[model samples]
Target: MKITYRFLLFFFSCAAFFHPIKNAVAQENWPIKPITMIIPFPPGGVADTVGRPVADALSRSLGQPVIVENRAGAGGGIGMAAVAKAKPDGYTILLALSSISIIPEADKILGKPPSYSLSQLKPIARFTADPTVLVVRSDSPWQNYYQFIDAMRKSPGKYNFGSSGNYGTMHVPMEMLKASQKFFMVHIPYTGAGPAIVGLLGGQVDAVATGPSSIVQYIKAGRVRALAHWGEGRLASLPDVPSFKEMGVPIQFAQWAGLFVPAGTSDFITNKLREASKVASNDEKVRLIINTAGSPIQYLDAPEFKAYWDADAKQMEEAVKKIGKVE
Candidate 1:
């Protein structure tokens, strides 16, 4: 009986050892199948513009197709929540935007249960940082940034600015501007940047604070006029337009997009994904697409990205507190 019991114990110990070995081997093999990159915004939007190119580049580097799937709604909360709760096996990832950092504060201000916390997602890398530009229709009387500000200061709440959504990335920066400049403009929130741009063109709103990519072509076509860019310097595509720093606003805002995986994703997989991202960011086609969107390719690896995300989240939180709840 003793000998039989010892045999069983040895067999169980071997099973335990080999089971982990198998799992480790599988993890080393990593993504034996296709991976999904969830954009959390509708197709043809800024997120899609960056997400698709990165996905294609990742597909090439990773030896597997990296498919992009858009899941748009609730100002990007739904898709982020799904990724936060998704399996952390590296198959599912998020192509998150700067808005992801603000959603938590927005939820709190709105008195809603948070969809996902910043802690729920792990940063992989950041690919692009596109500055926000305040733009108006070509025919608008205001030709420069000061003119727009003077108009708003003179008639509080007479002008309105459209944004992708309430408490979104676009909305936050505009609110900061409003707070700093002590001006008032009625806020008109749309479902996404695409819709907000449409509202601006249709005369539903006086101006829109958006990434240049969404309106660069329109600006070139003389359909819209860019007043002030919210960055450290002017965009290469629109050099004549001055940055907010140059205008004495002392505020720099950019709609940066990055890659993230569920928080508990294994280090091996995260490192692999980061390496693939590094390769993708350097791809010539990827650079062209991002540059054409009027966004500079700013890639940061996992640690740097985490630090950047944390700082940005804190800044957004304070900005939201100052702006208060936006109904």
Candidate 2:
């Protein structure tokens, strides 16, 4: 009997000791299969512009494919909730925009159930962060930034703007400007930034506020003219353009793309992703693609990304409050 007891104790000790090693080994072998990167918004948006390149680079770095899946809905809530509820195994990840912070705040303001709280996910890295630009068709009657504003002020609701969706990053900025300037522009919500741009071009909407990357091609093509951006200074790619504040709009906002995993993701996998991401984001090919598209890489590590996210979220919360409940 004493021999039996000793043997059982030895067995339990061995099991305990092996468990951590087992986990470590598993983590090391993580992503043996493809990883799903949920972009929360659809293709052709700024997120897509950066995400596809990052996924390609990350795949090569990790020796595993990073598949991008667009799960856009509810102003980006559908995909976000899926990521929040995803297992913390690193296979399912999110590369979302600053709207990641706004959707939940909008839910709270609208008195709806929160889609996903900021606490539900962990930031891995920030790939690109660019202040949104306000663009209108080149053939429009308004020739400059002030002309557009004066027209809107003179004929409230006569003009309309397209957005990705309600309470989306695009929507929030335009609404904030409306609140600040005391003017009205009918909001036409679309499925994604790509569609919003189409709407703008097709005359479905008069203008749009979008990430620099989303509209750079149109601006260069002479289909749309950039009025101004929501930045402190001009973008290097758009050196001739001016910021909204420079035009006396008194507003600022940026759209950012960042990688995130469900909270409780093991640090081993998170760190691995971070390392791979650092390389992927800095990849020369990826840089060329995005930079030529208009936005330069604005990379931020996890800690710094979190600080940036926190500040943006706080501002979003207040912006939602200011916009009040929208039916």
Best lDDT among the predictions, by candidate number = 2
Instruction: Give the alpha carbon lDDT tens digit for every residue of 1-327 in model 2.
Output: 357988999999999999999988889899799999998887899989999999999999989999999998887889999999999999999999998988888898889899788999999999988999889999999888888889999998899999999989889999988887888999999888988999999999999999989999999999999988889988997899899788787999989999999998999899999999999888999999999899899899999999999998999888888888877
**Clash list (residue pairs), candidate 2:** none
RMSD of each: 2.3, 2.3
Off by over 4 Å in 1: 1-15
lDDT of 2 at 303: 94
lDDT of candidates 1 onward, in order: 0.89, 0.91
What TM-score number comes out for model 2?
A: 0.94
**lDDT at 4 for candidate 1?**
90
Candidate 1 lDDT over residue span 1-327, tens digit each: 357988999999999999999989999998899999998877756788789999999999999999998888877888889999999999999998899988888898899999999899999999988788899999999999988999999999898998878887678889889988999999998777888888889999999988877788889889999999888876888999999898788887879999999999999999999999999999999999988877768899999989998898888788888888778
